[model samples]
Target: MASDSSFDIVSKIDRQEAENALNQARKEVEQRYDFKGTGASIEWSGDSVLIKANSEERAKAVLDVFQSKVIKRGISLKSLDSADPVASGKEYRIVTTLKEGISSEDAKKVSKLIRDEGPKSVKSQIQGDELRVQSKSRDDLQEVQRMLKAADLDVDLQFINYR
Candidate 1:
Protein backbone atom coordinates (compact mmCIF):
# COMPACT_ATOMS: atom_id res chain seq x y z
CA MET A 1 0.00 0.00 0.00
CA ALA A 2 1.20 3.53 -0.80
CA SER A 3 1.71 5.82 2.17
CA ASP A 4 -0.30 9.03 2.27
CA SER A 5 1.20 12.23 0.86
CA SER A 6 0.98 15.20 3.19
CA PHE A 7 1.70 18.90 3.53
CA ASP A 8 1.17 21.67 6.05
CA ILE A 9 -0.74 24.90 5.48
CA VAL A 10 0.43 27.95 7.36
CA SER A 11 0.42 31.71 7.43
CA LYS A 12 3.95 32.96 8.00
CA ILE A 13 6.18 35.93 7.20
CA ASP A 14 9.93 36.17 6.77
CA ARG A 15 10.97 38.47 9.58
CA GLN A 16 14.30 39.38 8.02
CA GLU A 17 12.60 40.44 4.81
CA ALA A 18 10.09 42.45 6.80
CA GLU A 19 12.91 44.29 8.56
CA ASN A 20 14.63 45.02 5.27
CA ALA A 21 11.43 46.44 3.84
CA LEU A 22 10.99 48.64 6.91
CA ASN A 23 14.50 49.95 6.56
CA GLN A 24 13.99 50.76 2.90
CA ALA A 25 10.76 52.59 3.73
CA ARG A 26 12.45 54.59 6.47
CA LYS A 27 15.23 55.63 4.12
CA GLU A 28 12.75 56.72 1.47
CA VAL A 29 10.68 58.72 3.93
CA GLU A 30 13.73 60.53 5.22
CA GLN A 31 15.15 61.42 1.81
CA ARG A 32 11.96 62.32 -0.04
CA TYR A 33 11.49 66.06 -0.72
CA ASP A 34 7.87 66.12 0.39
CA PHE A 35 8.77 64.41 3.64
CA LYS A 36 11.86 66.56 4.29
CA GLY A 37 10.15 68.99 6.62
CA THR A 38 7.19 66.79 7.41
CA GLY A 39 9.16 64.72 9.95
CA ALA A 40 7.87 61.53 8.41
CA SER A 41 9.51 58.42 9.79
CA ILE A 42 8.96 54.68 10.00
CA GLU A 43 10.42 52.39 12.61
CA TRP A 44 9.68 49.45 14.80
CA SER A 45 8.16 50.05 18.19
CA GLY A 46 8.34 46.74 19.97
CA ASP A 47 6.68 44.20 17.67
CA SER A 48 4.69 46.79 15.75
CA VAL A 49 5.69 49.29 13.11
CA LEU A 50 5.20 52.95 13.93
CA ILE A 51 4.79 55.69 11.35
CA LYS A 52 4.91 59.28 12.46
CA ALA A 53 4.52 62.50 10.54
CA ASN A 54 3.56 66.11 11.12
CA SER A 55 0.17 65.51 9.49
CA GLU A 56 -2.24 62.62 9.15
CA GLU A 57 -1.91 62.60 5.36
CA ARG A 58 1.86 62.37 5.54
CA ALA A 59 1.64 59.59 8.08
CA LYS A 60 -0.69 57.66 5.84
CA ALA A 61 1.61 58.30 2.91
CA VAL A 62 4.52 56.91 4.83
CA LEU A 63 2.44 53.83 5.57
CA ASP A 64 1.73 53.47 1.86
CA VAL A 65 5.42 53.56 1.07
CA PHE A 66 6.12 50.94 3.71
CA GLN A 67 3.35 48.75 2.33
CA SER A 68 4.80 48.99 -1.14
CA LYS A 69 8.18 47.93 0.10
CA VAL A 70 6.62 45.00 1.90
CA ILE A 71 4.93 43.93 -1.31
CA LYS A 72 8.22 44.19 -3.15
CA ARG A 73 9.65 41.85 -0.56
CA GLY A 74 6.94 39.31 -1.49
CA ILE A 75 4.81 39.58 1.61
CA SER A 76 1.06 39.65 1.24
CA LEU A 77 -0.64 42.90 2.20
CA LYS A 78 -3.09 40.86 4.23
CA SER A 79 -0.28 40.09 6.66
CA LEU A 80 0.13 43.73 7.53
CA ASP A 81 -2.65 45.33 9.54
CA SER A 82 -2.54 49.10 9.84
CA ALA A 83 -4.81 51.46 11.65
CA ASP A 84 -6.06 54.87 10.63
CA PRO A 85 -3.74 57.73 11.49
CA VAL A 86 -4.37 59.10 14.94
CA ALA A 87 -3.29 62.48 16.19
CA SER A 88 -0.86 62.53 19.04
CA GLY A 89 0.57 65.51 20.88
CA LYS A 90 2.67 66.85 18.02
CA GLU A 91 2.50 64.08 15.43
CA TYR A 92 0.13 61.86 13.50
CA ARG A 93 0.84 58.16 14.02
CA ILE A 94 -0.06 55.01 12.18
CA VAL A 95 0.55 51.77 14.02
CA THR A 96 0.88 48.61 11.97
CA THR A 97 1.26 45.00 13.02
CA LEU A 98 2.42 41.86 11.22
CA LYS A 99 -0.17 39.11 11.41
CA GLU A 100 1.01 35.50 11.29
CA GLY A 101 -0.64 32.12 11.62
CA ILE A 102 -4.13 31.00 10.71
CA SER A 103 -6.74 31.62 13.33
CA SER A 104 -8.91 28.79 14.60
CA GLU A 105 -11.87 30.06 12.63
CA ASP A 106 -9.84 30.23 9.44
CA ALA A 107 -8.46 26.77 10.07
CA LYS A 108 -11.96 25.47 10.54
CA LYS A 109 -13.01 27.07 7.30
CA VAL A 110 -10.17 25.41 5.40
CA SER A 111 -10.80 22.07 7.07
CA LYS A 112 -14.45 22.28 6.13
CA LEU A 113 -13.58 23.16 2.54
CA ILE A 114 -11.32 20.13 2.20
CA ARG A 115 -13.98 17.87 3.63
CA ASP A 116 -16.74 19.19 1.41
CA GLU A 117 -14.98 19.74 -1.86
CA GLY A 118 -11.60 18.01 -1.90
CA PRO A 119 -11.05 14.48 -3.22
CA LYS A 120 -12.63 11.81 -1.05
CA SER A 121 -9.24 10.30 -0.27
CA VAL A 122 -8.00 13.53 1.30
CA LYS A 123 -8.13 14.22 5.03
CA SER A 124 -7.26 17.42 6.88
CA GLN A 125 -6.58 18.06 10.53
CA ILE A 126 -6.09 21.33 12.39
CA GLN A 127 -2.80 21.50 14.25
CA GLY A 128 -3.00 24.65 16.32
CA ASP A 129 -2.28 27.57 14.00
CA GLU A 130 -1.61 25.29 11.01
CA LEU A 131 -3.34 22.45 9.20
CA ARG A 132 -2.00 19.18 7.89
CA VAL A 133 -3.57 17.75 4.75
CA GLN A 134 -3.04 14.17 3.67
CA SER A 135 -4.15 12.28 0.58
CA LYS A 136 -3.49 8.93 -0.99
CA SER A 137 -2.96 10.61 -4.34
CA ARG A 138 -0.44 13.42 -4.70
CA ASP A 139 -2.47 14.93 -7.52
CA ASP A 140 -5.40 15.34 -5.16
CA LEU A 141 -3.16 17.22 -2.73
CA GLN A 142 -2.09 19.62 -5.46
CA GLU A 143 -5.71 20.20 -6.41
CA VAL A 144 -6.52 21.13 -2.83
CA GLN A 145 -3.68 23.63 -2.81
CA ARG A 146 -5.05 25.25 -5.94
CA MET A 147 -8.52 25.50 -4.46
CA LEU A 148 -7.24 27.16 -1.27
CA LYS A 149 -5.18 29.64 -3.23
CA ALA A 150 -8.21 30.63 -5.27
CA ALA A 151 -10.38 30.98 -2.20
CA ASP A 152 -11.00 34.52 -1.00
CA LEU A 153 -9.73 33.91 2.47
CA ASP A 154 -8.65 36.80 4.69
CA VAL A 155 -5.35 35.16 5.65
CA ASP A 156 -2.37 34.53 3.41
CA LEU A 157 -1.58 30.83 3.10
CA GLN A 158 1.67 28.98 2.53
CA PHE A 159 2.10 25.28 1.79
CA ILE A 160 5.04 23.68 3.55
CA ASN A 161 6.68 20.37 4.43
CA TYR A 162 5.38 18.34 1.56
CA ARG A 163 6.01 14.65 1.90
Candidate 2:
Protein backbone atom coordinates (compact mmCIF):
# COMPACT_ATOMS: atom_id res chain seq x y z
CA MET A 1 0.00 0.00 0.00
CA ALA A 2 1.23 3.52 -0.75
CA SER A 3 2.03 5.71 2.25
CA ASP A 4 -0.23 8.71 2.77
CA SER A 5 1.26 12.15 2.13
CA SER A 6 0.39 14.80 4.69
CA PHE A 7 0.69 18.54 5.31
CA ASP A 8 -0.09 20.95 8.14
CA ILE A 9 -2.67 23.74 7.78
CA VAL A 10 -1.62 26.90 9.59
CA SER A 11 -1.38 30.69 9.51
CA LYS A 12 1.95 31.32 11.20
CA ILE A 13 3.86 34.57 10.87
CA ASP A 14 7.51 34.85 11.81
CA ARG A 15 7.44 36.96 14.96
CA GLN A 16 11.11 37.86 14.59
CA GLU A 17 10.53 39.11 11.09
CA ALA A 18 7.50 41.06 12.30
CA GLU A 19 9.51 42.65 15.11
CA ASN A 20 12.25 43.61 12.71
CA ALA A 21 9.70 45.16 10.42
CA LEU A 22 8.17 47.03 13.37
CA ASN A 23 11.57 48.40 14.33
CA GLN A 24 12.20 49.64 10.82
CA ALA A 25 8.77 51.26 10.78
CA ARG A 26 9.42 52.91 14.13
CA LYS A 27 12.65 54.42 12.84
CA GLU A 28 10.90 55.77 9.77
CA VAL A 29 8.14 57.23 11.91
CA GLU A 30 10.67 58.89 14.21
CA GLN A 31 12.61 60.41 11.37
CA ARG A 32 9.78 61.36 9.05
CA TYR A 33 9.21 65.10 8.98
CA ASP A 34 5.45 65.05 9.33
CA PHE A 35 5.30 62.37 12.02
CA LYS A 36 8.16 63.77 14.07
CA GLY A 37 5.96 66.44 15.61
CA THR A 38 2.67 64.58 15.39
CA GLY A 39 3.12 62.39 18.49
CA ALA A 40 2.46 59.30 16.42
CA SER A 41 3.61 55.87 17.57
CA ILE A 42 3.15 52.20 16.83
CA GLU A 43 3.36 49.41 19.36
CA TRP A 44 2.72 45.70 19.48
CA SER A 45 1.55 43.85 22.56
CA GLY A 46 0.82 40.16 22.62
CA ASP A 47 -1.36 39.55 19.55
CA SER A 48 -2.59 43.14 19.34
CA VAL A 49 -1.02 46.11 17.58
CA LEU A 50 -1.79 49.72 18.40
CA ILE A 51 -1.25 52.90 16.45
CA LYS A 52 -1.67 56.39 17.88
CA ALA A 53 -1.44 59.69 16.09
CA ASN A 54 -2.64 63.25 16.38
CA SER A 55 -5.31 62.62 13.75
CA GLU A 56 -7.03 59.76 11.96
CA GLU A 57 -5.19 60.59 8.73
CA ARG A 58 -1.87 60.48 10.52
CA ALA A 59 -2.78 57.15 12.03
CA LYS A 60 -3.64 55.77 8.61
CA ALA A 61 -0.34 57.04 7.20
CA VAL A 62 1.49 55.27 10.00
CA LEU A 63 -0.48 52.12 9.24
CA ASP A 64 0.53 52.43 5.58
CA VAL A 65 4.17 52.61 6.55
CA PHE A 66 3.75 49.63 8.84
CA GLN A 67 2.11 47.66 6.06
CA SER A 68 4.97 48.47 3.69
CA LYS A 69 7.48 47.28 6.27
CA VAL A 70 5.52 44.07 6.80
CA ILE A 71 5.43 43.47 3.04
CA LYS A 72 9.19 44.12 2.75
CA ARG A 73 9.76 41.46 5.43
CA GLY A 74 7.65 38.89 3.54
CA ILE A 75 4.71 38.93 5.95
CA SER A 76 1.28 38.42 4.43
CA LEU A 77 -0.99 41.47 4.47
CA LYS A 78 -3.86 39.24 5.50
CA SER A 79 -2.34 38.84 8.95
CA LEU A 80 -3.47 42.33 9.93
CA ASP A 81 -7.06 43.09 11.03
CA SER A 82 -7.29 46.73 11.96
CA ALA A 83 -10.19 48.27 13.85
CA ASP A 84 -11.68 51.70 13.44
CA PRO A 85 -10.04 54.53 15.34
CA VAL A 86 -11.23 55.65 18.76
CA ALA A 87 -10.84 59.13 20.15
CA SER A 88 -8.53 59.97 23.01
CA GLY A 89 -8.15 63.66 23.65
CA LYS A 90 -6.41 65.27 20.64
CA GLU A 91 -5.03 61.91 19.42
CA TYR A 92 -6.67 58.81 18.02
CA ARG A 93 -5.76 55.16 18.39
CA ILE A 94 -6.47 52.16 16.24
CA VAL A 95 -5.98 48.55 17.19
CA THR A 96 -4.94 45.78 14.83
CA THR A 97 -4.95 42.03 15.35
CA LEU A 98 -1.91 39.96 14.37
CA LYS A 99 -3.54 36.72 13.48
CA GLU A 100 -1.07 33.88 13.83
CA GLY A 101 -2.65 30.48 14.36
CA ILE A 102 -6.13 29.07 14.06
CA SER A 103 -8.43 28.96 17.02
CA SER A 104 -10.38 25.82 17.94
CA GLU A 105 -13.42 27.20 16.12
CA ASP A 106 -11.39 27.89 13.02
CA ALA A 107 -9.73 24.49 13.19
CA LYS A 108 -13.11 22.83 13.34
CA LYS A 109 -14.29 24.98 10.45
CA VAL A 110 -11.31 23.93 8.35
CA SER A 111 -11.80 20.28 9.19
CA LYS A 112 -15.46 20.46 8.26
CA LEU A 113 -14.73 22.36 5.06
CA ILE A 114 -12.24 19.74 3.97
CA ARG A 115 -14.45 16.78 4.82
CA ASP A 116 -17.33 18.35 2.93
CA GLU A 117 -15.54 19.79 -0.10
CA GLY A 118 -12.23 17.94 -0.44
CA PRO A 119 -11.58 15.15 -2.87
CA LYS A 120 -12.66 11.63 -1.91
CA SER A 121 -8.99 10.69 -1.60
CA VAL A 122 -8.34 13.39 0.99
CA LYS A 123 -8.87 13.23 4.76
CA SER A 124 -8.30 15.91 7.38
CA GLN A 125 -7.88 15.93 11.18
CA ILE A 126 -7.69 18.89 13.51
CA GLN A 127 -4.59 19.15 15.68
CA GLY A 128 -4.62 22.07 18.10
CA ASP A 129 -4.11 25.29 16.15
CA GLU A 130 -3.51 23.39 12.91
CA LEU A 131 -5.04 20.70 10.77
CA ARG A 132 -3.29 17.74 9.21
CA VAL A 133 -4.56 16.73 5.80
CA GLN A 134 -3.50 13.48 4.23
CA SER A 135 -4.03 11.61 1.00
CA LYS A 136 -2.79 8.45 -0.60
CA SER A 137 -1.70 10.46 -3.65
CA ARG A 138 0.29 13.69 -3.66
CA ASP A 139 -1.92 15.00 -6.43
CA ASP A 140 -4.91 14.89 -4.09
CA LEU A 141 -3.07 17.01 -1.57
CA GLN A 142 -2.14 19.52 -4.25
CA GLU A 143 -5.73 19.68 -5.34
CA VAL A 144 -6.78 20.26 -1.76
CA GLN A 145 -4.39 23.16 -1.52
CA ARG A 146 -5.77 24.64 -4.71
CA MET A 147 -9.31 24.34 -3.44
CA LEU A 148 -8.47 26.01 -0.15
CA LYS A 149 -6.70 28.84 -1.93
CA ALA A 150 -9.68 29.37 -4.18
CA ALA A 151 -12.03 29.57 -1.20
CA ASP A 152 -10.17 32.62 0.17
CA LEU A 153 -11.72 32.83 3.61
CA ASP A 154 -11.14 35.75 5.98
CA VAL A 155 -8.44 33.96 7.94
CA ASP A 156 -5.00 33.59 6.42
CA LEU A 157 -4.04 30.01 5.57
CA GLN A 158 -0.77 28.38 4.61
CA PHE A 159 0.21 24.81 3.83
CA ILE A 160 3.36 23.66 5.58
CA ASN A 161 5.42 20.66 6.70
CA TYR A 162 4.33 18.49 3.85
CA ARG A 163 5.62 14.95 3.98
Candidate 3:
Protein backbone atom coordinates (compact mmCIF):
# COMPACT_ATOMS: atom_id res chain seq x y z
CA MET A 1 0.00 0.00 0.00
CA ALA A 2 1.21 3.52 -0.81
CA SER A 3 2.09 5.68 2.15
CA ASP A 4 0.09 8.82 2.83
CA SER A 5 1.43 12.22 1.91
CA SER A 6 1.15 14.97 4.50
CA PHE A 7 1.83 18.68 5.09
CA ASP A 8 1.40 21.20 7.87
CA ILE A 9 -0.34 24.56 7.69
CA VAL A 10 0.94 27.31 9.95
CA SER A 11 0.89 31.05 10.47
CA LYS A 12 4.21 32.60 11.40
CA ILE A 13 6.22 35.77 10.88
CA ASP A 14 9.92 36.44 10.39
CA ARG A 15 10.84 38.82 13.23
CA GLN A 16 14.08 40.03 11.64
CA GLU A 17 12.29 41.04 8.45
CA ALA A 18 9.64 42.85 10.48
CA GLU A 19 12.33 44.75 12.34
CA ASN A 20 14.02 45.74 9.09
CA ALA A 21 10.75 47.14 7.81
CA LEU A 22 10.22 49.15 10.98
CA ASN A 23 13.75 50.58 10.73
CA GLN A 24 13.17 51.65 7.15
CA ALA A 25 9.94 53.36 8.11
CA ARG A 26 11.62 55.18 10.98
CA LYS A 27 14.39 56.48 8.70
CA GLU A 28 11.83 57.77 6.23
CA VAL A 29 9.88 59.52 8.98
CA GLU A 30 13.06 61.21 10.17
CA GLN A 31 14.07 62.42 6.67
CA ARG A 32 10.70 63.34 5.21
CA TYR A 33 10.16 67.07 4.79
CA ASP A 34 6.54 66.96 5.96
CA PHE A 35 7.46 65.18 9.16
CA LYS A 36 9.85 67.94 10.25
CA GLY A 37 9.11 69.39 13.67
CA THR A 38 6.11 67.05 13.99
CA GLY A 39 7.84 64.89 16.62
CA ALA A 40 6.91 61.83 14.65
CA SER A 41 8.64 58.63 15.65
CA ILE A 42 8.32 54.88 15.19
CA GLU A 43 9.99 52.42 17.50
CA TRP A 44 9.72 49.00 19.06
CA SER A 45 8.21 49.17 22.52
CA GLY A 46 8.87 45.76 24.04
CA ASP A 47 7.23 43.14 21.81
CA SER A 48 5.00 45.61 20.01
CA VAL A 49 5.58 48.52 17.63
CA LEU A 50 4.77 52.05 18.68
CA ILE A 51 4.03 55.02 16.41
CA LYS A 52 3.80 58.50 17.77
CA ALA A 53 3.16 61.86 16.15
CA ASN A 54 1.94 65.32 17.09
CA SER A 55 -1.46 64.77 15.49
CA GLU A 56 -3.81 61.93 14.69
CA GLU A 57 -3.31 62.34 10.92
CA ARG A 58 0.44 62.25 11.30
CA ALA A 59 0.26 59.15 13.46
CA LYS A 60 -1.86 57.39 10.84
CA ALA A 61 0.59 58.51 8.17
CA VAL A 62 3.42 56.99 10.14
CA LEU A 63 1.47 53.75 10.35
CA ASP A 64 0.94 53.84 6.58
CA VAL A 65 4.65 54.22 5.99
CA PHE A 66 5.39 51.29 8.26
CA GLN A 67 2.80 49.15 6.52
CA SER A 68 4.21 49.97 3.11
CA LYS A 69 7.67 49.02 4.26
CA VAL A 70 6.38 45.72 5.63
CA ILE A 71 4.62 44.95 2.35
CA LYS A 72 7.78 45.72 0.43
CA ARG A 73 9.57 43.26 2.68
CA GLY A 74 7.09 40.57 1.56
CA ILE A 75 5.15 40.42 4.81
CA SER A 76 1.38 40.29 4.79
CA LEU A 77 -0.52 43.21 6.33
CA LYS A 78 -2.94 40.76 7.92
CA SER A 79 -0.24 39.63 10.33
CA LEU A 80 0.13 43.17 11.66
CA ASP A 81 -2.68 44.23 13.95
CA SER A 82 -2.66 47.95 14.67
CA ALA A 83 -4.86 49.78 17.11
CA ASP A 84 -6.50 53.08 16.29
CA PRO A 85 -4.58 56.23 17.15
CA VAL A 86 -5.17 57.34 20.69
CA ALA A 87 -4.46 60.68 22.28
CA SER A 88 -1.69 60.55 24.87
CA GLY A 89 -1.03 63.94 26.37
CA LYS A 90 0.25 66.10 23.49
CA GLU A 91 0.76 63.33 20.98
CA TYR A 92 -1.21 60.61 19.23
CA ARG A 93 0.08 57.08 19.49
CA ILE A 94 -0.68 53.93 17.53
CA VAL A 95 0.35 50.53 18.82
CA THR A 96 0.72 47.49 16.59
CA THR A 97 1.38 43.85 17.45
CA LEU A 98 2.60 41.16 15.12
CA LYS A 99 0.35 38.11 14.96
CA GLU A 100 1.72 34.60 14.54
CA GLY A 101 0.49 31.05 14.86
CA ILE A 102 -2.91 29.72 13.96
CA SER A 103 -5.28 29.63 16.86
CA SER A 104 -7.23 26.46 17.67
CA GLU A 105 -10.41 28.04 16.28
CA ASP A 106 -8.65 28.93 13.07
CA ALA A 107 -7.24 25.42 12.81
CA LYS A 108 -10.76 24.05 13.12
CA LYS A 109 -11.91 26.30 10.33
CA VAL A 110 -9.26 24.91 8.02
CA SER A 111 -10.12 21.39 8.95
CA LYS A 112 -13.75 22.06 8.22
CA LEU A 113 -12.88 23.47 4.84
CA ILE A 114 -10.93 20.36 4.00
CA ARG A 115 -13.75 18.09 5.03
CA ASP A 116 -16.35 20.04 3.13
CA GLU A 117 -14.46 20.89 -0.04
CA GLY A 118 -11.35 18.76 -0.33
CA PRO A 119 -11.03 15.36 -1.96
CA LYS A 120 -12.54 12.41 -0.12
CA SER A 121 -9.21 10.71 0.51
CA VAL A 122 -7.84 13.77 2.32
CA LYS A 123 -7.92 14.01 6.10
CA SER A 124 -7.02 16.90 8.39
CA GLN A 125 -6.11 17.00 12.06
CA ILE A 126 -5.54 19.98 14.28
CA GLN A 127 -2.22 19.88 16.10
CA GLY A 128 -1.91 22.69 18.61
CA ASP A 129 -1.36 25.89 16.64
CA GLU A 130 -1.05 24.14 13.31
CA LEU A 131 -3.04 21.78 11.10
CA ARG A 132 -1.74 18.61 9.53
CA VAL A 133 -3.31 17.29 6.32
CA GLN A 134 -2.79 13.78 5.04
CA SER A 135 -3.91 12.05 1.88
CA LYS A 136 -3.20 8.94 -0.05
CA SER A 137 -2.66 10.93 -3.24
CA ARG A 138 -0.12 13.74 -3.57
CA ASP A 139 -2.37 15.45 -6.11
CA ASP A 140 -5.10 15.77 -3.47
CA LEU A 141 -2.65 17.46 -1.13
CA GLN A 142 -1.69 19.96 -3.84
CA GLU A 143 -5.35 20.65 -4.51
CA VAL A 144 -5.94 21.31 -0.83
CA GLN A 145 -3.12 23.85 -0.86
CA ARG A 146 -4.65 25.60 -3.84
CA MET A 147 -8.08 25.60 -2.24
CA LEU A 148 -6.76 27.07 0.99
CA LYS A 149 -4.89 29.75 -0.89
CA ALA A 150 -8.06 30.72 -2.71
CA ALA A 151 -10.11 30.89 0.49
CA ASP A 152 -10.66 34.31 2.00
CA LEU A 153 -9.27 33.56 5.43
CA ASP A 154 -8.12 36.35 7.72
CA VAL A 155 -4.98 34.59 8.89
CA ASP A 156 -1.91 34.19 6.71
CA LEU A 157 -0.98 30.57 6.15
CA GLN A 158 2.18 28.75 5.09
CA PHE A 159 2.44 25.13 4.02
CA ILE A 160 5.35 23.11 5.34
CA ASN A 161 6.71 19.57 5.86
CA TYR A 162 5.24 18.20 2.69
CA ARG A 163 6.06 14.53 2.15
Question: How does residue 118 of candidate 2 score in lDDT?
Answer: 86
**Alpha-carbon runs more than 4 Å astray in model 2:** none
Model 1: residues with Cα > 4 Å off, grouped in runs: none
Ranking by TM-score: 3, 1, 2
TM-score per candidate, in order? 0.96, 0.90, 0.97
TM for candidate 2 is: 0.90
Better of 2 and 3 by TM-score: 3
Instruction: List model 2 lDDT by residue over 92-151, tens digit each.
Output: 998988888888897888788788898898999888888899999999899889988998
* Tens digit of per-residue lDDT, candidate 3, span 64-88: 9999999999999989999999998
- In order, the Cα lDDT scores of the candidates are 0.95, 0.89, 0.96
Give the root-mean-square deviation of each candidate in angstroms: 0.9, 1.7, 0.8
| Residues 113-157 of candidate 1: C-alpha lDDT, one tens digit per residue | 999988889999999999999998999999999999998988999
- Identify the runs in model 3 with alpha carbons over 4 angstroms from their true place: none
